[model samples]
Target chain A: MTVQEKSWKEIPPAGICWKPSTEYLTGDWKTYKPIMDSEKCTRCTLCVIFCPDGAIHWNPGKEDIEFDYDFCKGCGICANECPTKAIEMKLE
Target chain B: MFSEWKFTAKDIAEKADLFMSGHRACAGCAAATVMRLVLKAVRGPIIATSATGCMEVVSSIYPYTSWATPWIHTAFENVAANASGIEAALKILKKKGRIKQQRIDVIAFAGDGGTYDIGIQALSGAVERGHDFLYVLYDNEAYMNTGIQRSGGTPHGASTTTSPAGTVIPGKVQYKKPIADIMVAHDMPYVATASPHYWRDLITKARKGIEVDGPAFLHTFAPCPRGWRSDPSKSIEISRIAVETCIFPLWEAINGEYQLSAPSKVIALRPERKKPVREYLKMQGRFRHLFTPKFEKIIDEIQQLTDKRWQRLLKKCGIV
Candidate 1:
């Protein structure tokens, strides 16, 4: 969504931000994508803990980890730090 | 006495996200991870205040904020002061029956630049006054928000824009200031040094800090890929190696009594298990110049200093 142009007086006083940053999608910054191999996964959740973006999730229903590509910047940290090498970074 | 909160990975996963995704933090930014873990440990209403630093700038761009809780952005030197005021106001509101919540956690976050140098006065005053808040310093070891400039927390032999490595001089000439020890000297109820690599320990310490009645301080080692010239994906690895090398030991002080944390405790007990400082430096490009033959003495000096500091810490903890 385009940011609406506002006059200086229209802006919130003291620069208060009313919206949550989740509205901004950062996945566009990805040059690489983290692909997970369920077979090799240990479900250790290190990626979930270390993810700077908080984009990785532990899906209780599937009993496995999942990635939210909508916000993942493809840092390759999950792939790099995965002990079992379950996650791999592939070109976007 | 504080009962430990044993949080598993699943438990953390199930919790609500206080620090949301899609913020502008760099990929593999360990400071962001520090913020996430700290927020995860606390339950109930939270009022977070951040000094002017990378986390503040990246998380709260104009019009959007990563924080789900009430957050205030303060100047570089007064985050703790701001938290102090918030805590005071909250106390008054609760006493007057204006606020319904029985308790509110006030947390202040600052980078090494703000905590170690610029904001040290405010932090000291707030802690000395015994404010009911937790001051978390995500120390990246330099002024990373502006540029790679050396801060008081920057270790010896590390290169930055201000302390450039050259033939004439090595990197930073001085050693890292003992900010944790300084905080402990304030006689606060809780003070801890943590690293993001050890999330459980960090989370537990954060909880204790929040639960304590008086002021608490947490110095967290945050690796900056851009500033340190390290691979972004290797941030955790670097953090782990730093602990293993005894350069940044994980330890805490309760009521002025020091005790090494699990990871650092093991190394302290079995000194042989400790990795060489070279292993830690090799991962980051900031110390690339130190690998040269001419700077061999500088590397040895750093290793010597690290070992000395480790031994000193062991003594402080009464391990030796």
Candidate 2:
């Protein structure tokens, strides 16, 4: 009813998608963040490789991994996949 | 927890998401998980053709869509053909100079029911015609959206709604369709079987599948917790057990050369480290009936079949 009530000029062009994929972020849905124990981290970058959300990155200067909490869903997959158990997920 | 793997979680986290979240997939759904992994393989523009299944329903309801990239929801039986059409149109556009950018990777996603049954003919035609595209089948082993009806890809001894385990029948007694092997016989450049638990291997295969010149088929093990009667969170864990027990192996045939992926490769290397089949069988409720004394022979049959299947795979890969 709301859509039909709109004026002719108010309606968007047909066959057009207004919202794109970038608008959908999952930061609010996460419950944890993976914290890497740098001392045990082998720099294998498995954490960077398996993070589905691209929430982790390599600190080029420090040569350690860093987490971008904005995109991290805290799936704990990084902690699970970490070979040395160097990464542990902390509750958000 | 033990294997020689190169990439880390850090590496995967650095890549941007092409398959966005907020989709309506089941919690811990393996299909949705694999979708994310496969999307990571393609960094550039992609056009995906999704069949009418869980992904289509969950991702593309009335007002919203979960796909970050452009996607089309095709019919239940003609997804491959639809994808092939898109591939052809793209090539034509490139030839006519109407499109002046990099080649767009066209991918078709389907469930096991769409792939191993209704869509097989269209799939065969597309692959046989030498279309350059990747067809990924997220095989959850049944028609989950329609209340778990038995499909052609359903494994032997698994009970579904249509093939219920009753006094007269044990379950769906037919073997799984050899999709990966059959695709390889099509002589496509790449054919792989992957699992969501093995993201590194799956990602690599997805990239290879897209890069190949002709049709590439990827059969991914999508664990349906609801259908399988397992804890939703156990999707990845149960899949890991499936591979460790050599029941759902991770393998790929690149240019006709078969190779076992991680965990499977590790397990196959050690002769004395074979995991017990019961460990995997006990996790899923569909296989629960097999544990009873009356069904011990069925259990034995399953185990024997698993061993024989692994042996056959090893022989094909030249490990034997």
Candidate 3:
């Protein structure tokens, strides 16, 4: 997570990004967290499709949806768009 | 109709993540979803170029990039131009046996400000030259990246920083420019308007746009919670209500032949299915002033305009 300062001559031209953005944890921005109710879940995937952050994932081993809280900013879109009301947004 | 191209949740989950998370987009940014769906639809090697806008700014910070695929960041007015060059170079490289891939989709992502106004000339020139690429315009209705300034895609009554709703003026004075129809006039192989709410349709159109031989244009409606002054969670609902109210209809034109998409087709066939413009307007804070008694007439005007445009589109699609 530390940003290493490189010499000006060592930097690549055109401001190239050598690393992927996954290192940045965006979960701190959330004021609310979405908790999924597996009992009422239909696995219709509406929440997965509408999630702006791509934080919701279909776990094949467990055969259920999992939330990656590291990237989930807790927009509540999954909670709002869930047909079965399986996802509830709770204050973090 | 697009059942064959429909993507199940598993199918989408199985696809390689092209647009990664941990970028700087807002909590409920619809444009981010648009980018994700588009890359998912392409499902192949892609060389993406983006104009300077919200998505570009958010995805490509100095030290990191959200795009897993090869991406180039260009200036505000030359994303299409950049894509055109990339496609031409790839073609040459393939001819010289330098590249191994059979086909590499070139996609240019731009916001409404870049597509409708600043970069229109470059886009027009690139498409007119018959470049093999897909130009995806994610229209959030205004210049949202630069603090909600007005753009050509801003609707007639939506207020912005540049076009404030006041005693003299009622938000933006001009209607949204028909950028999709303008591209259709170029006689490209594919042209379509989509919203993130209709993810299936949007992905389908994106696939077709990429697979086409000549240039293609996809005008996507992306709801901005910050600029629109609405709930971040309601972005999908706002996009859905937009189509239901006929404010932003889903349709496609193939070689200048217009046809309504499924959602709009239902409304075109059964007029009663169409919701009032008020329902759509009431959701966004940008149009809050229009609900006041002084601006009540503007709402009626908007409704009349919506109905008129819907009828015209139906006639064009030969559904009337």
Worst 10 residues of 3 chain A by lDDT: A1-10
Question: Per-residue error at B59 for model 1, in Å?
Answer: 0.8
Give the least accurate 10-residue stretch of model 1 chain B, judged by summed lDDT: B1-10
Model 1: per-residue lDDT, tens digit, A1-92? 57675877987888798778998999998899999998999898889988999999988888888899999988788888888999999998
Docking quality of model 2: it rates as incorrect
Question: TM-score, B chain, candidate 3?
Answer: 0.98
| Model-by-model DockQ, in order | 0.83, 0.22, 0.79
Q: Which of candidates 1 and 3 reaches a greater DockQ?
A: 1
TM-score of chain B of 1: 0.98
What lDDT does candidate 3 reach at residue B305? 88
For model 1, state the Cα shift of residue B268 in Å.
1.5
TM-score of chain A of 3: 0.87
C-alpha TM-score for every candidate? 0.97, 0.83, 0.97
TM-score of chain A of 2: 0.70
Q: Order of candidates by TM-score, top first?
A: 1, 3, 2
lDDT for residue B177 in candidate 2, whole number 0-100: 82
Using DockQ as the measure, which candidate wins? 1
* Per-residue lDDT of model 2, residues A1-92, tens digit only: 02443454764665333444334455666776677888998888765654444456677678777877755666665776677999886887
